[model samples]
Target: MHSLNVALGARSYPIIIGSRLLGDAQYLLPSIRGRQVCVVTNETVAPLYLARLLDGLPGFDKVDVVELPDGESYKTLNTVNRIFDVLLEKRHNRTTTLIALGGGVVGDMCGFAAACYQRGVDFIQVPTTLLALVDSSVGGKTGVNHPLGKNMIGAFYQPRLVLADTDTLATLPDREFSAGVAEVIKYGLICDAPFFHWLEANMDALLQRDAAILAYAVDRCCRDKAAVVASDERESGRRAILNFGHTFGHAIETVQGYGVWLHGEAVAAGMVLALELSLLCGSINNNLLERLRSLLRKARLPQRPPAEMTVVDFLQAMELDKKVVNGRLRLVVLKSLGEARVADDTPREKVIEALKNCGVR
Candidate 1:
């Protein structure tokens, strides 16, 4: 197992990445400070790995499992309430810990529950999907999606530990696996140029599920994200760069309706638009844009926004993005392949032009 710390001082936590870690108490037991535990997962994952996880927490005074319905559409306050009902009925107190045991949707909701329940409580992240392990699980950003926006209603609650067992990914569907690759590609586009170039040459090995390459990619992303989170835990400054393609991506998610396009898939298409905007802004050339598109295509992710979406649809949804400060839209644009900066000065017309150029009509 390989371990790294987020370096948040008092809130610092370790992230452990390895194979077959789910059923190991040695890794999980040390993180839990309380005797009561709740394992939050989804119906799809419960059948496959829930028993293995439950087997590890043998001596807890109280242990419970909340199997949520699986899907992006189910990530909401209503679904989170189910966890509250169980915790309350079982008399779990403030010291109880929440163990998120599934994908991004499960991790987000469980983390949010731990943050809200009893004001606050400890929680651990055991991200099963590649998307969660590389992005959502490491960052302390936890919340459910609002009808108006994606993750607009969440909080910044760090986990006590993030235990990512690459073994869980064995059962991930091909489409879902491809979706995860989109975020992995994002790290290279925003900050890690060499990793991007490495991905260009090694994407085939990654697609084949080469264990070493996948673990390296996951570790690299986690380290990249951990540094950002430690510097700007609440996204008050440079942390916004992490949302490189997310402004346009979140717009696609809201317009297409949640679950229609997977978050990573939408972000893949959104990155294309962001790249086009960067090209028009004179920060990047056609060569860089094409290189990213080629990589995305090889990953089996979408290279364009959904056909039914319109320029107006995108604008309306984007206006609700959290980055909008003082009514001005702030977008993370690429200054170069390995550098990005937030630009509030981007003209509304320029955004529309980029949208039109990218087939948003």
Candidate 2:
């Protein structure tokens, strides 16, 4: 087992990465301080792993289980309220600990529920998807999607612990697994040129879900995220780089009507667009862009948005993104294969060019 600390002092927590961690009580005992335990999951995830998770938490006065309708479209106040209603019905108090037992959507909604339940409560993330394990579950960014945008209504509620039991990934559908790979690629793209090269060499191992490669990737991503969260917990500066393709990614999700294009799929296409913008900016060469496309295509991720999504449709949705500050839309763009920065001064036409040229054709 490999564990990394998020380093926020009093708010610091450990992210445990390994195989079969969800069934181990040792990893969970330290994080659950309360007697009431609530496990929040979705329809698809509940049957396969929820029982095993419950078996690990041996001694709670009362335990609650909530199974939400699965999919990104269901990430909203209504679904969150279902978890809230369960907590309230079970008469759980502030000391109650909420355990998120599925993918990113489950983690985000459960964390938000914990954050708002009687003000605040403790929560743990047992991430079942690659995207959650590598990105969303590690950071304190928790929120549901709004029809107008992605992750719009949410809170910065950190989890007490994040258990990434890679064994659970065995059940993810092929497309879902590919989606997770998108976030893993983001880590390498934003920094770590060597890691990106490693990905190019080992894309086959990742696609087949090799245990050693999976653990290594998860551990590296956790450590990367932990360091970033430690430095900029509220995204005041450096943390924004982690969003890499998210500005465009979120717009893709909103325009595609959520779940139609998975989060990682949208991000994969978004990264293509982001790199195109960087190319137009004269910062990166065609070789780096081809390398990105090669790796993504090898992983079977979407490299472009739907052919019908127009440039104007994307521009309209991106205007409402959370990353926009004061009237400037700050996008995470590549300086090279291993470096990225936030740029708000991108010319509208160049931005349109990226939207126009790199999009579905």
Candidate 3:
């Protein structure tokens, strides 16, 4: 098992990554306190791994199962309210620990629900998808998407523990697996230049789901993200760099409808757009842009925005991004191959041109 810590003073927790860690009780039972524990997951993941978790968590005297509909569309205030309904129905108190199972959606919503329930409660993240295992599950970023923006209605609620089982990725659809790779590549693009080159060489190993490669990628991404989260837990400054492709990506999600494109897919295209803007701004050279695009293409991700979207649609949707500062959009741009910074002074016309260049109507 590869174990790492996300230090948040009193709220610090451990992240355990490996194969079949979910079925192990020692890793789970210690973090779970009190008698009642609630497992919140989506429909797609329930049949596959819920029972294994339930069986492993024999330490809890009272266990409740709350299964939600699968997909990004269900990540909403309405869905969180459903979690509240279940907690109230079971007479759960503040001591109840909510276990979030499945991918980023399940982890985010469940963590949000736990934070809201009885003011605050304990929760664990069992991230089943590659996206969750590396990025979303570890950073304490919990929330649901609003109609207006992505992750706009959310909280920075840390989990008691995060357990990522590499075995689960084998079951993921090809598109979903590729989507997760987009985030992994972000780790390299934003920081870690050598890792980017490594990814350039090893994209096939990841797509093949080589056990060792997956473990290494998840561990490396988690360590990098943990360092950033520890430095700026609230995204006050440097942490915003983590939203590398998110501004435009979130716009794609909002315009296309949640779950249609998948979060990672949109971010994949969003990263391409970020690189384009950077190229136009003279922040990066053409070779760097082509290298980034080449890696994304190798992963089977789209290099451009969907043809159905318009420039106006992107701008309007991006206005809802949480990175807005006093009405100015703060986007993370690459200063070099492995360095990124927040730049709110991005020219609107250049952004429009980049959007148009990327196939936005």
User: In model 3, what is the error at residue 292, expressed in angstroms?
Assistant: 1.8
Q: Which of 1 and 3 is ahead in TM-score?
A: 1
Question: By TM-score, is 1 or 2 better?
Answer: 1
Give the alpha-carbon lDDT of every model: 0.93, 0.90, 0.91
Candidate 2 C-alpha error for residue 310, in Å: 0.7
Per-residue CA lDDT of model 2 for 190-278, tens digit only, reads 97788888888888998899989988888888888888889999999989999898888998899989899999999999999999999
Q: Report the C-alpha lDDT of model 1 over 1-361, residue by residue, as the tens digit.
A: 9999998889999999999888989999999998999999999999999999988788999999999999999999999999999999999999999999999999999999999999999999999999999999997889999888898787899999999999999999999999999999999999899999999999999988899999999999999899888989988888998998999999999888899999999999989999899888899999998999999999999999999999999999989888788888899899999888899988888999999998888
Off by over 4 Å in 3: none
- Put the candidates in lDDT order, highest first: 1, 3, 2
Best by lDDT: 1
Worst 10 residues of 3 by lDDT: 53-62
Look at candidate 1 and give me any clashing residue pairs. Answer: none
lDDT of 2 at 294: 93
